[model samples]
Every structure is written in C-alpha cells, then in structure tokens.
Target chain A: MPSVKENTIVTTAAAVELRGLRKSYGEVVALANLDLSIEPGELIALLGPSGCGKTTALRTLAGFETTDEGKVLVDGDDITRLPANKRDMGMVFQAYSLFPNMTVLDNVSFGLRIRKANSAERTRRATELLELVGLPEHAARFPHQLSGGQQQRIALARALAIQPRVLLLDEPLSALDALVRVQLRDEIRRVQTELGITTLFVTHDQSEALSIADRVGVMYQGKLEQLAAPAELYSRPATAFVAEFVGTMNRLPGLMNGGTVTVAGRSLPVDGTAPASGSEVDVLVRPEAITLRPAEDGGGLIIATTFLGSVTRVRARLADGIEVSADLPSHQASALTAGTHVTLELDEQPVLVAAPLPR
Target chain B: MAQPVTARLGRGAAWAAFAAYFLVPMGASIYFTLFDRDNHFSATPYTGLFQASGFVPALQMSVEMGVLTVVVLLALLLPAMVTIQLSMPRLRPIVETLCTMPLVIPPIAFVAGIIALQTRLSDADPYGPLSQLVNNQLMQTGLPLLLVFSYVVLALPFAYRALDAGLRLLPLRTLVDAARGLGASWPTVLLRVIMPNLRTAILNAAILTLALVLGEFTLATLLGFTPFPVWIVTSGGDHAQQSTAASIVSLLVTWGGLLILSVFGDRRRTA
Candidate 1:
C-alpha cells in the first residue's frame, strides 16, 4: 500500500477550484454556493443521494451546467464562462455514452480524431488505452456488442485519450450490476492512480466513495455537508446527516448540557457546541462502536440478527424499546441466539449530536 | 410454448384479409398497365415507356427542382436547427412550438399564404425585396426562391422532427462540452461534432424532403412553376397512359432514393 504522504503529494496541487457556485432551474435550486477545491492528480468522490446536486456539481466542473454565480477556476485560470466543448476536461457519463455508431477502437480514438492527431498516433494511443482498460481484444466490436461494464471501460478510455487535465465521472458505476460495479470501481481507481489524473467522481454509494476516493464529500440537498478522508467521514462525520449517511447509525434521543449529552438514562461526553441544558439533541453511535455481551439479567433482548460473513449485525431492543445495533465477530455472534439478552457498552469517545426531532 | 392451432388459423385469416385488400389493388393496377381487356399480357406500356419523350424534360425538371429544393432547404434548415438546439434551454419549448406550427397549418393554406405574402411584398417594392439593383430583370429570369421557400415550409414538419430526434438522441452535452473544453470555437463544434453526428438524420430528412419536393403540386401550380408534379397533373388529361407511365417512373425513382437512404442510414447507425 502506498503511504498517505505519497497520496497527498500526488493530489495537493489545487487542480480545480469552485467558489460560491450557484445554479437554479426555475424554482428549484440545484446547486447553492458550492465551494470546493480538488487537488491535482487526486481522485475525490462526491457522494450524495439523488437530487443532492453531486452530478450537477460534476457537470458544472465539466462546463456542462453553467454556473449562475461564482467562478470556476482550473489551475488558477477562471473558466466559468468557458463553453463545455472548450473546457478541455474529460468526462465519463453515467449512461456510458460510447458512440453507438462507432466501434470500441473508434470510440476510444474519437477525441484524438477530433483534435486532428495523426492517424498513426491516434491508432497507437487508442490501442494503448484499450489495453489499459483490458478491452484491447474488443476494439473491433461496436458499442452494442459489448457488455455494460465493457462499454463503460471504453467510455473511460475515450475520455482519457484526450489527456484531459481533469477527469469527471458522473455516477459512472450507478448503471452497472453490483459485481461489475465493484470491479469497475477498482479498475477506475487503478487507472486513475496509474495515470495520476485529477478526477472528480460522483456517486450515491457511500461505500464506493469511501473505498475508492482519497477524500469523500457528502452532499445534501445541493449543499456539501462534509468533506473529509474516508476514516474521518465514517468515524467522525461532521454533521448528523454525514454520520447517518456515511454509515448505518443508531441515533438516540438525548438532552445536551455543555460538552455532554444525556441519553437513555446515561450521560456521555460529546464534542462541539451543545445546546442549553435539557434541550433536545440526537446522539449517533455506529453499530461497530457499540459492544454487546449476553446480559446476565435480561437487560437487552436481541430483536434481529444478520450474519454478514465475518461479522454479525445484531439489532437489539432495550427494555424501554430503544432499538440499537451492534457489530460483533462471527464467533461472538454464533454464541448469541434470537431473543438472547445482551449488555451494551457504548464507545467511550463522543458521537455526533444534532438538534432533536420535533413531536 | 407452441402457439395453438386456433391462434395460428386466426393469424392466417388476418393475413389473407390483408392480402385481399392491399395486394389486390396493386395487382389490379399492374394488370391494367400490362394487360388489355382481351386478357393478353403485353409489354406495351414498358415498350412505350422508352419512346415516351415527355419524361425527358419532366425528369430533368424534377431532378433539378428536387436537388434545388434539398440544397436550399438544407442551407436554411441546418443552421436554424443548430441554433434552436444550442440556444438557451429555456427557449427550447418555444422554438419547438414555432418549428411545429408549420405542420398544423395545411400545405395549401401555407402555399397560399406564401404567395399572398410574396405578392404583397413584391408589390410594395417592384424589385421584390432585393430587386432594386436589378429591377425587373431578376424577376424575368424566374426565381424559384419563393417556390422552394413554400416547399421548405411544407417540409419543415418532418425535417424539424427528424433533426430534433437526432439532437435528442445524441450525447449532446458531452459533445458540446468536450469541444468547448478543448478550445474549439462554437463554429467548430457546430461544424465538426454536431454536424457529423447529425448525418443520418439530415440525410433521412433531406431524402424525405426531396420526395416531398418532387411530388408537390399545389404550390408549384399556384406559383406558375413548371415543376414535375404540376406537369404530371396537366399531362393527365392529354394522355392518361403517358401520365400513368410518368407516375410509375417517378414512383420508382422516389422509392429508389428512399431505399438507398434507409440502407445507408441503417448501416451508419449500426457501424
């Protein structure tokens, strides 16, 4: 594994910058003052649910979506007014827009052909790209002749053929089956790494964003809720939305006082500003963060258990019916049966707290 | 699972009915053209077709008119189509509505309107808008501009629909963005990426437009033009057999062009 230092050096040159970006269509605002800085050669995933504007943000960078306000700077040059065709950025669409009329080689070589590269060079480079994507054997086949995964790979190779300064992927894997999605995700990361191209990947899959991206930005309703490394995002999500979205979180209703939150008849230390004492708050704890043991006196009853290969996910309910989940090793899980009572140990570290829901 | 015999029989009866209705009329037309009342099959019409000198002039005029209609309409429509497509997305609905308006207005009414407008405009200025320099000289030469303009108006519905479908089916955003990003000017993108992708649609529309131009009647007649359709109609009373021969020849030519277009279009798409 490459060290974090190597990754940082490769990705920290400020490749693209978005400042106070805003876009609206009629009454619905798609992106609102989105500010982001992508480092050169970095692969950053913009993760969000549908309509969160992650795709919109990627399009804005690609110059497909015009920004109503704010400047988009690429390598310190403002390109906000630049037309999409002049942006010189490469993009792989979610639909894998490999030209159906062209063969895989022709599709991959389209950018070079458009730029008027010498025919020999175009063919040579296209062949290299097809090989890079592991589809050199399929070059003669038209787009319809290939599988969805193969088509997307060709799309990626085509985008890269231009040697674009920035690569934009808009939900590139969302259209693929699960197994192929994972396979292609890894392949994309490998290719991006090998080429050291600055890439902005948009996806709604948290696991994809975390596993493949050097950093993940969680977008919510056209605003970025948090942007951080995968571990930080999962372990220390910046907001309740981030915490719940990045991972499965069991939230407990609580009251905040100073740096502590009172939940389920127990007081726990928390970070960040707390509302006035007795004010409602939401305390989030990850399933893995909570430890469980068979309760001697039947305190916590197992309501549900899901075996997840190496680990077991236990959905338990307290006597008061507060549902909480715990992740235990497979061996530990095997010892516990349905209806088994368990004791809980919440991680000592503080969890994220947000304003409580109203009745 | 195999289809039931009853279903198969039902389908066979439907096909028989279809043959009786469609093939029967066509077969009768061919029979009438080939055989006389005595039921003797003679190649008289086919033999007479070669000696038919009426087709020479008519064929030349039809080809000239069709080519002129296509070149002029494409020169007018392509830019308009590109402009409408790449314009502000908000204005798309309005542009689309305007483009489709010609379809709703009947061709006869459209030609009438064009003639009336041309007369009104020409009367207001004897040189006919650009007539000042040349005066009545240009008008005397018989400009087919207005005639072709009417044809374009008639053809706009199919042309616009085809072009719109082409633009919609294309990965337009990526194409535009890729071009612009690469520092290609708007003109370059319009000429390069947009035009290449639109070849099939443009060809199909142009072929259909050519067919429309070749077969058009009311507009050419109203405008006092000697185009094929008007000639064919006027020739009908003088020689019914000659008119039938002309119609068959024109149909074959038109069908040939359509066949070529369909084959090429299919190949281009699948290639």
Candidate 2:
C-alpha cells in the first residue's frame, strides 16, 4: 500500500455538513429534514434499507438533487444552490458510468480534459491514478474489456482525477460478485484513508457499512436513527431498530426489575436506558452473548445446527416457545444436534431492554 | 449437435418462404432488365440507361436531395430528442406521436395540402412583399427545397424509432450526469459525450432518411420535380427495359449503402 503522501491531494480534508435536508415527490417524502456532520478526513457510511433517504442525502450533497429546504456546507462554504458540475465533489454511482467511447486512460483524464489540462499533464495524472487503482496496464483498454470490479476501480480513479474536496460513493460495489465486493470494499477504505478525503458512502448492506465506515449512521424512514462507531453500533445500538438492523439481535420476553432485565430466569444488567421496573419488555441479546450447556433434563431443545466454518450457529427453542440462536466455537457445538436437550444461559453482559411491540 | 427432424423441416420451410418472398421478385427484375426484344440476352438496355436524356441529372438531384434531407433531419431531430430526453422527458410521447403523424397522412394528401398552400400564396397580390418573394424566379427554381422538407417529415418516424431505441440501450441519464458532473457544459456533454456514444443510432437514422428520400416518388412527381424514381417511371413510358435496368441499379445502391452502414455500425460498437 502507498503511503498517505504518495497520492494525497489535500493535506487537510474538508469537513462536510448537511443540515435540514428535506425533499419530496408529490405526496412521498424521500428525505425528511435529515442532518449529518462529518469531521475532516472521516469516512461516514449512511446505512439503511431501500428508500430510506440515504441516497437522497448523498445526491443532495453531490448537487445532483436539489433539496426542497436544506444547506450543504463543505469547509464552511454553502454549496446548496451550486450545480453538480461546480460542486468540486467526486461521485461514483452504482453503475460503472465510465464513458464507453473513451479508453480507460481517457476516462480517468476526462475531468482534467474538461478543466483544460494539457495533453501531457492529463496523461501524467491519468497514469498516476491508474497506478493508484492498480490498473496501470489496462489504461489503454476501453471499459467494455474490463470486468465489473476493474471498471469500478477505474471509475474511482476517474472521480479522484480532479482531486475533489470530498468523495461520495453511492453503493459503488453493490453490482459486483461477493468476492470482488469484499476485495474492492477493502481497497476503497485503504484509498480513502491514504488520501484523507472526507467521504460519505451510502449503502443498504449493513456489513459493508459496518466494516468500512469510521461511523455508520443507520437511517430509517428518512431519518438517522443512530450514528456511532462499528463496535459501538453493534455492541450498544441507540435504538431497537439499529440493534435489529446492524446484526442479529434475539428478542426475548423479559421482565424489567429496577435497572435489570430478567431473561430465562437470569437477571442481566441493562445498558443505556432501561425500561420501567415491573413492566414487560423485549430484551435484545446478541447471538454470541448466549451460552449453552448440555443437561440430562434441560428445558431448551436444539432445533438446528449450522456450521459456519469457524463458528457453529445453534438454534434452540426454549420451554416458553421463544427461539434463540447462539454462535459458539465449532468444537463447542460439535456434539450438539437437533433434539438435544440444553440449558440456555445469558452471559454476564449489558443487554438492551425495550417496550414490547404493541399487538 | 444434430438437429431434430421437425426443426430441420421448419427451417427448410422458412428458407423456401424467404426465397419465394424476396429472391423471386429480385430475380424477375434482373431477368427482365437483362432480356431484350425477341428474348435475346443483351447489355444494351443496362448500358443505354445512362444515355437516356435527363437520367444523369435526375440521379444527381436525387442524391443531392437524399444527402440534404439526411442533414436536415439530423440537425432538427438529434438535438431536439436529446434535449427532450435529458430535460423534458414528459414530452417524449407527445414528440413521438407528432413525428409518427407523417406516417398516417398519405403522401398524396400531404402533397395536395402543400400545393394548395402554394397556390393560395401564388395568387395573392403581386405588389405584396410576401407574394412577390414567393413568386420570384429563385423560389421557383428552388422549388425542390420543398421536397427536402417533406422528405424530412416522411423520414421522422424511422429516424425517431432508431434513435429512441439506441438511447434506450444506453445509460443516457447517467452518462449525461457524469459528464456534467465533470464540468462539461451542455453542448460538450451532447456532442463530445452523448453523440459519440450514439454513433450507431445516428448512422441508422441517417441511412433510413437517405433510403426514404431516394426511394420516394409520389410527392416528388406530384410536386413537379424530377427525382430518380420519377425519372425511372417516366423513362418506362418510352423505354420499359431501360426503366427496369435503372430500377435494378437503384436497388443495388440502396442495398450496398445499407450494408456498408451496418458494417460501419458494428465496427464502431466493437471499437
């Protein structure tokens, strides 16, 4: 990997601020007063399901969509009304978007050509970008000759050619196969960090966002439900939606007593805000947080076991008819099979307690 | 793999149908053009077509009009369609409907409307400036310019369909947005970015327009113009063999032009 100084365009990255961004089409509200702030050189991923306003916010910041009411500030300058061409922001769409008529080298140098850079300078910068993207040998080839991964890499290089102040990636790797998606996702993170350019990545893939972003902002119904670091978002999600969306969270009926929630006859301390005492609540627990012990007359029945390489996932139906899954070391779950009797025990950890859904 | 018996039979039947529909008529035309009086095969009719009076001039006029009509059609439709696609997409169906209107209006009816309008303008007061200009010698001499305009209308449906289908195959909105995002102006986006990508579509539209103009006869003859098709029909009055020979030559030219265009289109797409 190249050092930060090798291809860094800006010594200090720009800070981006999106405030009160609201957009609607007829009676449908795409974005409802969404606000977000990014520190300089930080990569923030707006993670959500489809139609969650994650893309709308990114487009508004890129100047592709005009917000009905909002302000987009980069480095303290308002660029809300600026046309997309003048925004000086690099964007990679879900599609390749590489100009089909041009070679890979020409596609990378397109922005420079539009900026009136001389031919020699264009070639030099374009060559440098191709090298950065690890496609220096394929520069002479047109887009059609390249694979989906290579095309997206070239697209990233092309967007970075102009050295824009900010980088906006809209699900840039969603179109690729699974293996390529992971490889390119890591490469993008490396490139972004090396350049230290503030970036906003919008994606519906929770794992992609969690694994790459400095902060993952979970969006739901045109609003940011929670924004935190990956570990923090996973370990301590601010809301039930975030907890359910980021990773698998088992919802088990529990009784809240004071600051603790009793689940499966075990009282576990609550994290964040706990529900009122003596009120029924749904306790959310991570799969890995649950442990199983075989017993001659246990109340839990192992419904199924799935081998996941390093870890084995065991699904158990409790005596109360609630199903919960547990991920244990393969060796630990090797003897457990369907119909095995086991006692489910909660690990001593902070669990979230929320009001049960209204029937 | 060996073909199934039923599939082979179906394929054979299709080939026989194709030969009967296309090859038979083409062979008859060639045979008629080659054979002369007393059933003697001779090249005189084919060679004598060039010697016929007004034949060369009519051919030249038709070629010129074909090229002009293609140029005019492209100039008017390309930008208009691109603009509508990029900015006012809601107007696309309306524009398509209007372009196809020429297909529903018969050529004879359209020519009658044009002649009626011309006669009304011609009979206006001579001292009136518009009437004087309309009756001028230059206007009378350039009456064939009206044929170019009418040809453009006639070619609209084919041109629009070709270009529209081509646009559908492309990520047009993304291309435009990418170009504009790279700081390209609208004209630069259209010409440098959009048009180059649409090479095959533009070629198809131009070929369609050229073919339509070259083969058109009714409007040209009724409007008192002597294009190639009209000349072929007129020559048949006194020389039937020569007319068939000219028709065969025109058919070859049209087929050759289309073949070259398709080859060029394929090469560009691969390139």
Name the best candidate (by lDDT).
2
DockQ of all models, two decimals each:
0.42, 0.62
Q: Please state how well chain A of candidate 2 matches the true chain A, as a TM-score.
A: 0.96
Q: Is the docking of candidate 2 incorrect, acceptable, medium or high quality?
A: medium
- Model 1, stretches more than 4 Å misplaced? A1-14, A264-266, B1-54, B71-108, B124-129, B132-143, B161-204
| Predicted candidate 2 versus true structure: per-residue lDDT over B10-100, tens digit per residue | 9999999988999899899889878765788988778887788989889988898889898889889988998898789999999999999
Q: RMSD per prediction, one decimal?
A: 4.3, 3.3
The TM-score, computed over Cα atoms with residue i paired to residue i, of candidate 1 is 0.88
Q: What TM-score would chain B of candidate 1 score versus the native chain B?
A: 0.82
lDDT (tens digit, per residue) of candidate 1 on A1-359: 33223322222233899899999988888898999998888989999889988988998888877888989999999999877766778788887576655678877777777788998988888887877888888989988888999989998888888888898898889889999999999999988988788999999998899999999999997888899999988988888888888889987788887779877667888866667787888788899988878977968898888999999998898876788988989899887788888887787777778876553
TM-score for chain A, prediction 1? 0.94
Task: Using DockQ, give the best candidate's number.
Answer: 2
